[model samples]
Target: MQLLGPAQENLTPRGMKARGALAVMGTSVNMQIGRPRLQDLLFSERDQEQGAASIRQLLREIRIALGPHRDAVVTGPGWVGLDGQIVALDMAGRAGADGRRPEFAADLDIADPEFEDWLRDARSHYEDQADDQLAAGIADDGTPALILQAPMSGDLQAAVTAAMILQEAASRVGDVLPLHVVHGDPGIGKISLGIELGALANRSGNDIVILFAARLRSDGRLLWSRRFVLPAEDSAAHLRRVAGGVTVAILHGVEALREVVTDPRLRRMPLQDVFSYSAVRLRRADEQLAQIDPNGDRAVILALRSYIRHTMLLERLAKNPQEEEEMASDMAARARELSPGNPTALGVNAMVAAWKGQSETAFDMARHAIAIDDENPIARLAYSSALTGMGHHREAEAEASAAHMSALSELGPAAWVLRRAIAATRIGDLRSAERYFATTHGYAPENRPALRFLSAIRYELGDEQGAQAALQKLKKLEPDFTLELMASDAYPVDSLRRAGLLKITRSGLI
Candidate 1:
């Protein structure tokens, strides 16, 4: 999802109070960059150490700004760590814990170091040193401290560091021309994280202005959107322009870099996504991957998805996340294209159709997916969805039940059971509904739907008091109950009042 608004013109004084840090995340489907997500990299000892060293260097300069108020920087100056590092949480969450801040945070960096000396439109040139380090961490003495946060959720520290590194790397090109690439995987929140970092840097009053390839709309602008085309051989120059104009250059997508590398005219424009300096292979670098968790399917999916997203990100491919259930279809398609025998690739076509309201297509894919590998969980779920959509009530119930039975406890069973119960209710099989609820109750006692649906079934069978009791429990389970939520969208009319099957004298109907 897009962020709420355009990047603030300034890192406003108000903006300083936030858990502010960019997250660098991308998938590892093809494992190009190696790691599943950039977040994975942040958790590593290597990144933590590098981040700490970089932050310390930045902080040392910042301490100069605070001058005489240095000792008052910390909430309590006398506290010490086990070895005298001085613990912030020593006051018990009052000051800090590792990097958790009770207040806000700010940051600064020369987005590109190589271009640091490049002259902008005017005589002024960007300095390689950071310009806005003063706002990083505020001192308790009314001065600011350089607050270096640890890598928490979303791999925030890595994101900031990546921007820093990327900027420096761009400068090394020495071309002093247009072009820069901001490549990464999909849904790893790359766009947002990049936006945050660029915005954070710019807000610190860095002179850098992101040059968009096109003018940004109001909404796009809020996303810190910028557009530009890099010269075939002018990759470094363009970056220098953006960096020289401002303290940092903000590149939005990988395509930005692709232009420079693939340019036919440039002699030094990277012939490939690589740069060689000493032991470093900067371009076309294989991402270092994290260890996989055999128990997590989503993790596996993410690992795969990252690669696909990265391809698109770097290739400048278009995407539509809201085209209704297209993710599975896209995944299935890619799985076949990339690794057909993987078993997970079989039923993609059907899943896509089903998501688009094509029951028949959904059913067909589901069957095909199962025929290829009945034991496949994703395939089974896809098949069950198709069956339900096609009104194969009995088959849907059986298949969903089978899915539940086949799944591991580590993968909770309630969602599958709920699908089956919905099918039973749709078919008006009162007995079937009763059985489904019974099974659900035993397996998941806390399942609210089991009690509520059982109540509805009892009412259908003419057990007035039993129905009344179920409704009361239902009320406890759902204080603001309505027939609409309890039923499917296929109901003939808007409310239960229109249904010939049930009678409700008051309240909203399904």
Candidate 2:
């Protein structure tokens, strides 16, 4: 079921390759995935309160698979799939630890007896892995971190790459941004991208929060919600704190954006004026800036920035030309002869540059998007994410948080939380992470990123017992899972820790 592209069956996207030892952690780790179990997991909230055996099995499987891979750079697309695998491996790892302690009760599964049976085995296994010096849980002796991926899909792509959205949302960010939400169709992987970007932001030294708008009540309703807040300007300066947890925002589906940005009172601005008629005129002018060579991605990025912003402005000023940016008729006449630029198509160009890690160029284009229309959330998020990518984390986080707050959209909130949480983890504040996770869980209980992140915090705090329990819980939620797939390179994983953030002593395996 792949797309028809490049005319080669075996050809894969150059960026889509696997290497290193990566770990993926999911949210619930439930069993019997797909349809039937989905019904139980999605609708049977009350029944889930009691726990289920399906989840236990899911955890066991992930453990069995990854328990063998020890230490390596594992990459993958989303944490939901990856967490399923971690739960499995954690179960296997913990089994050995609990085998010795038959009397110690864990914090999870207060009422369930079946979980009790699985707990003994899972705990023992985790203890063994912890001591092995070959796991993400262990001190940096080459053990990889338990990477919990967020969900991913085409529909959610905007949240990951849109520049305008990130900026506007970031502007509203604060020390206690309570919510960050990504609203869109399922399967687009918006949730996954938002969380990952946030984590990346956090790594750069920022505080964040996350909550998903995803609702259990209905499929067509808001699908994701998140909440978070960055530390204030004067947080005692462990490192002269600069940015919010999230620096940018990316969102797709213009219609969805309107739906997600809930507050009518606050301004739901775009990064640029892509929808206004005046923007069309600017876009036509920017078209002249398009590059003829691929020597660098910058040219394309700039061109795209103009397209997105202009298109956004045009959309906003649909009713009248003079009332808006006013580049409409004049630009339209020129466009009639030379044709206007394709904003959406150009925007994709900027994403390509960002993916290649050309943050400077990405930021430039993203800013261009914002310049077109300061109120565009996509441009805001895109610009902020780019800034963070360029190492301007504080600036990016601030931009992302503002967009989320004013836009009142789920994506904005999610971005804010992720950034803040990552910042907390990088600084070794496990307790703070736990608190953030609690908030995000309240919004989207099945969010794999939050669950896996919590697991990492638990491990860092020496809560091996708690970590094992969380992994097992995830197993019950998604059954058809594997650690190998979750850890693949389908997701965004920064290889090798940033130089200053961690002190590393290379072990036998990378």
Candidate 3:
């Protein structure tokens, strides 16, 4: 667990592998794991014999690290375990005496994809555990402060002017935004924004200032960064333009950090726990949010609940569409009421209205959100979905393209590309639709709708093998899915019919 320290550079490749093996074993239940599981975690690319040999060698390296406690590792015919009586795993000791949490096994770099996945999961698990342990210790201030650090080197006067402009621009972007800019070093549980300026002179001796800005989390992890080059002469106009751009980027970072500071419950939950499409997981999040914000005073919490209901409707998680739509509408209304000028709440409301078949309301809400912040990807996506629902394919495709360009997260691209693909299909552009669907699948492989449409589009393009492969994956995710269901009203019947999949399947040609 404590692989990162001053002596990390002294470790050999074998020593690193030994630490990785110990990481896998230490995080497991009771510090015990099956031999096959251990082999898969450490040497998945090797054959059975080679993997077994690697595990044995790794155990020897671990024993050497253990020194006098070499007998702590116990091996059976089919399992490996750490002796509880002799070995004690102190996860908390991995942190500094000042209680700063470091990355788990930060120095252990295994080349296998399986091991990488396990390491990422382990890091997230430990981070959440640390969040829970530290949540109660955070001071309850009236408003969360965002620390703005002065440049390390540059024109001191110009940097101060730039910081002031940035603050003013951020304040004007939203009516009820919850960020207070302060000039100082970052305190615990606060986000820090820093700017750096470098001078670059052209051959003609014209000077330019290269401004680099970065936002860092409480733990010093980077949230966002950007660079801008501005003419040194008459920096007033150029500084304003740069501040406008930086303000938008700052908003993006603040949006990500706001939830963590505002909602203590969210701090302990993984990102996937809130954004998942699984009905069970969504239900759990809904229940937890309700417990914390029972009256729905938190606009972000209400918006998230609305999002969960909207996703349940789209995924067909609920048997009663009418009831689900009503719930989504209620949550969206509450969120809008709480934050009247908030673009995110408006975007969620628009999407819910679109799903409920209220075209006028959806269009109004989506357009209003866009009018507030044109670069808001959620608003753009909501507008595209509304237009697509109203049979305006060309307009929807344009909006979807904008959404994809403005998207800051992985899920945004997946959602917008699916919209673009659907619009392409509606306009009889099968080739473009196929490419968009493939891109969406690349962004989110677990997306069932993307897989379903990919299958239909491939079959239409005479790629039977590819179509069948997609269909097989979809069947694995949804065991009840079939050609019959694809033709029914439950799915996008119009898109399937346009692809000629339904006709071919009914005629037994598929």
Candidate 4:
């Protein structure tokens, strides 16, 4: 891995798609060569034969160039070949008598773009393999890494604001806020900020555990208890065994966030009250700022924030419609008046319309949004969700796939994958569902909705053991899951989506 670090670092985001190949050492009939399991060679028909011939010719040249030492050359994986395989050597030690193994390994500047591309791909492929093993429940030593890290870099203001909020929440006296709701526009970095806060708490000597909310199907009580005592059979019992510690759980997921806010047990816990990157707050602040300077440079930003906040309100109402009457009163006209030309606003408006069961308006708004700015991933994701609500599974999948490929952030990709997985599942495309499910799992292993979807997919795919395993993991995460609770909190209320979910639940070991 150390030998290939430079090549991995050289990979640009666009360069990641280019196929890689090797072209050297193609003269000696006596020498042999080996290659890693690369994607391009595995998939491409022409590259298969060309790659094999190139490697063979390169080995022949190497054997002829080295003279008598040609016998010492051992083919290996990675860049360097050793013992007839690509091997990563401990270069700190002295070189062996056989010159094939270098005494001290020097970093090679792989000038060939193809070779560099191969190295980068191989490095990422192996890294993913390592992560999968870790996720498969590897036993840990007594000393565990306490710091919670975010996958992507976080905003400075978001991080600092989260830290401050957590610190402030710690000083609350009596009848304090149960859960500090970090409300925001979709794809606005609320979860990312939560992760950054968790890391900060970890650094401050707190036991920080971050969980994605989408990974469970139970009530907030069971969900919180489950993560605290994971790997233990009795989740609630383990919570009692560990008496005292400044443990802060930074949960990320809209469903999980909703549950936490409503849970009665929150008052007893030490939760940080963070509202980092909230569109609602931004809108309120903008309203105040307008008083000072009516034509302020931030008017456009304020307008967009208002639209986002309204859209978010509609999303919340979609799940639990208790606030529908209160929110829908003047929100529609306000949303339109705020950002009429913005594609994102139109997409969000579509979602709001769909949630309200206004199919015609939703479909129209979604198409208009896409026509205006097809590259806007957030808008695309919103439109895809709207399509799903209207029972257009195939169309939803296409929109989601496009958004997934174009998404620049960790959360956006995860959201798109989840949308695509659900759409594929509805259309009976189990393979696509399974693939997207895996990608979503990679992004957020503990996401409850994702775990449920994966379990259902595995069951339908005839992998009963895999399905049971997923259920077992879900059980450990949400011990209170039941048919009633699942219907209420797990599946959407849309008739088609609900029926599809019912089939899966009945088929699976749920």
| Candidate 4: stretches off by over 4 Å | 1-321, 324-333, 407-411, 472-480, 487-510
- Each prediction's Cα lDDT score? 0.37, 0.35, 0.65, 0.42
In TM-score terms, candidate 1 sits at: 0.31
Cα lDDT, model 4, residue 99:
17
lDDT of 2 by residue, 1-510 (tens): 111112212211121101000111221334112323322432344365343444344334433433443211122332123323322222211111112212222323323344344446645654564323221121111111111223232222222322222333333331012123332212221121112122212211443222322221111233333443333242233111122222222233222333543423222223233222243543543442232112323322333343443333323322343332233223322322332232222233344456556667767766666665444444455666576667765565566556546533353354356545544454455687567665655554544555556554565566667655655554444353333333444422232133121111111111
What is candidate 1's lDDT per residue for 1-510, written digit by digit as tens? 011111211111112111111111001112122222221222233365564454334334333433442331221232111111211111111123222222211132223332122213111211221122212222112210111111122333333432443454333221111222233212111111111123222211222322222111101222223333333333444553333222222222222423322323222212122211111222122221111212223222322333233222222221443432244445546555554443334444555566457788778767876776565545666687688777677788788777676522113355467557766776677677767776766665545556656666666677667666656665654455556545545322221222233443222322
Tens digit of per-residue lDDT, candidate 3, span 347-404: 8999988876688889899989889865555667788877877778899888787667
Model 1: lDDT to the true structure: 0.37
Off by over 4 Å in 3: 1-145, 148-226, 230-292, 319-321, 407-411, 492-510
Task: List the candidate numbers ranked by TM-score, top first.
Answer: 3, 4, 1, 2
Ranking by lDDT: 3, 4, 1, 2
| Top candidate by TM-score | 3
Indicate the residue-level lDDT of 362 in model 4.
82
Better of 2 and 3 by lDDT: 3
How well is each residue in 1-510 modelled by candidate 4, as lDDT tens digits?
Answer: 121112212111111112121211111122233353332332233366775555555455544544544553455554323332331222121112221222111233444555556456645654454323323211121111111222111434333333333333222110111222332111111121111122221112223321221112111122322122222223233231221111222222321343444433222121111111233443454343344334433223332333444433422312334454334323434545555765655665666676667887888887887787565444576688778777888898887876666422233356668888888887888888878887877775545566677776677678888777777776765667654554564344343245354444565365
